[model samples]
Target: KHRWAMYIDVSKCYGCYACVAACAAENNVPIGVFRTWIERHVTKGGTVIFVPKQCNHCENAPCVKACPTGATYKRTEDGLVLVNDDLCIGCGACIQACPYGARFFNPVKGVVDKCTFCEHRIYQGKLPACVETCPTGARVFGDLNDPESPVSQLVKKMPTSRLKEWTGAEPMIFYRDLPSEADL
Candidate 1:
């Protein structure tokens, strides 16, 4: 089965906002709202860390199930949960359902907006804008179903984890070398 996943190596991140700006420009994400954002985490050892944040594309997506207008749905081909703008009612229910606070209301479009995993670029067999523009190659995207993929290999070779695992969202994104202060 084809599946979607993103692996971020925190050790490689250097507080570069490349991923943030790239995603915004590619997706046309509105101003004053971010589809994704990066947080700076500082630990007791005086070690500062950069953590990129975005939707987890949960297996049991509460955002998808909570949309009253049937706007949010998961792609069967790649498992990227997306919103249908035309069908969206701007109820903002999904925004609350997301534990990571990844969803936001777009004042310009008058609907809820969240990450689409760059479906536009992915459909062209190209990487997401953020992943493509990452200078450090910190963000890795691939079909996690393929054991040979770099993301799969990293998952196998390292102790990685996702956010809010107790929520049972079954997040597809993984993080490695995360400092305890980040706790993502």
Candidate 2:
């Protein structure tokens, strides 16, 4: 089984919003919301850091549990958390349950929506728009279950962190070289 995952090298990010734009264009995300976005943080010493934020596609996703209509679910095969629009009631339960604030109520669709790690493209053997558009090569996406995958190798060899670890959501998105002072 393929376990899809992403590795973000914080040290390589330069605050470019190419990922953001690509995600919007690829997913047809509404004007005011995003599936993936970049956050700019400055430490006390005034050093700027860019952190990319998106759905972690957690192993224990709160959004999956929170959806009353069974619209949100985690796919066991690839471990991708996805929303079933036909089942979605646009109740915003998943939005509130997401610790990473990755889910959004799509005004256009009237349903909760978020990153699918570009599932359509991935299954077609293409990279996610965010990963492909990243000029800095900061984002790496692959099957974590594959020993030879880049994501697997990076996680094995690099120091990494996931957001809101205490929540026990078991987020799959990993950040390499994340500064301690970035305030999550």
Candidate 3:
């Protein structure tokens, strides 16, 4: 499987939100339900900062294993997490099962919705909308398994983190910056 990874350089990101808009427009993500979203971990006495986040597509993905139906699955070839809309029952079990809160139930589609790493764009050998449109050049995407990929190089060069490391999800998304508490 291709090692998929996203690197977010927090230092470069200044909460501009171009990535958020791009994800919404490119994927037609619903208003209330987002395939990709941001989580601002504010800290340092109201000194707020933003971190754009989405599915990490973990190696041990709970969202996939918890689906009572065979709707959520990871592609063994590309390391992409996908939800089979046809197989989804809208049970919402996978929604709660996700440690990252990445899964959203789409009432219109009657299935779970989350970032598919821009599968449509990936198929065309294009960057994910979020990464491509980030005006600050904060987001980088590549195959982590490939040692020479840009993502892998950045990860090796900087300090990075994934949320909820204790859960052991092995999230592929990485953050180079984070907010300090007290701003919260």
Q: Model 1: residues >4 Å from true position, as ranges?
A: none
Tens-digit lDDT track of model 3 for 92-147: 88889888888897767767899999988877999999999998888999998889
Give the per-residue lDDT digits (tens) of candidate 2, residues 1-184. Answer: 9999999999899988999999999999999999998888887778899999999999999999999988899898889999999999888988899888898988899888899999999999999999999999999999999999999999999989988789999999999977776636
For residue 51, give model 3's deviation from the true position in Å: 1.0
lDDT of each: 0.87, 0.92, 0.82
Give per-residue lDDT, candidate 2, residue 160: 93
Q: What lDDT tens digits, residue by residue, belong to model 1 across residues 15-132?
A: 8898889988998888789977889988789988899889889998888888888899988877989989899988888998988899999988888888888878876889988899
Ranking, TM-score, top scorer first: 2, 1, 3
Q: What are the per-model numbers of colliding residue pairs? A: 0, 0, 6
Most TM-score-accurate candidate: 2
Alpha-carbon lDDT of model 3: 0.82
Q: What TM-score, to 2 decimals, does candidate 1 have?
A: 0.94
Name model 3 segments beyond 4 Å from true: 180-184
Greater-TM-score candidate between 2 and 3:
2
Clashing pairs in 2: none
